[model samples]
Target: MKKGCLIGGIVLLAILSIALGYYFYQQSKTDPVVYEFESPVYQEIIKKTVATGSIKPRKEVQIKP
Candidate 1:
């Protein structure tokens, strides 16, 4: 019947629309344009340093009762 044909057409259109949307979504995540450029200048960079140690004394004190 004509109703069955209409339903079939609607289903086909919906499937095609979803497929095209997913295809375009996958294409937007690529970085082809941003990776082609290089930096123009370079500079000297300094990093932070850390020191760790323990101190010792010559005599020890005792408490009397």
Candidate 2:
């Protein structure tokens, strides 16, 4: 019984060590993503109209100085 317990303890220790090593290896290969953001904002958005044109005088008025 003592021999069996010793063997089991050694096996359990080995398994734990291997699992821990694999866990750390995977962690080292990964980059942790940290996301920081602002809270929600409620407001009105105004829509603007874009026009392309040139203004011309309907009638040319001559001014004498």
Candidate 3:
């Protein structure tokens, strides 16, 4: 049936996507890009991706009295 085939195709694509994502994630874990910097020249890092305007999180410290 056409409906059965359509559902099967969607399921197949979903499984393929998950498998590909897992493979790429595993590869990145082992072979990630690393950037080392001298203490002074580190300000040039791109704070966020160009399209999205998100900023990095700041550390927080709490004082207990």
Scored by lDDT, the top model is 2
Model 3, 1-65: lDDT tens per residue?
A: 99999999999999999999999998878666799976755456556555757876698788899
On the 0 to 100 scale, the lDDT of residue 60 in model 3 is 75
lDDT of 2 by residue, 1-65 (tens): 99999999999999999999999998889677899999999999999999899989999999999
Rate residue 10 of model 3 by lDDT: 100
Across 1-65, the per-residue lDDT of candidate 1 in tens digits comes to: 99999999999999999999999999878766655678788888899998799777799888799
* Residue 9, model 1: Cα distance from true site in angstroms: 0.4
Which ranges of candidate 2 are over 4 A from the true structure? 31-65
User: Where is model 1 poorest over a 10-residue stretch in terms of lDDT?
Assistant: 30-39
Between the candidate structures 1 and 2, which one is better when assessed by lDDT? Answer: 2
lDDT of each: 0.90, 0.96, 0.86
Ranking under lDDT, best-scoring first?
Answer: 2, 1, 3
Q: Which stretches of candidate 1 lie over 4 Å from their true place?
A: 31-65
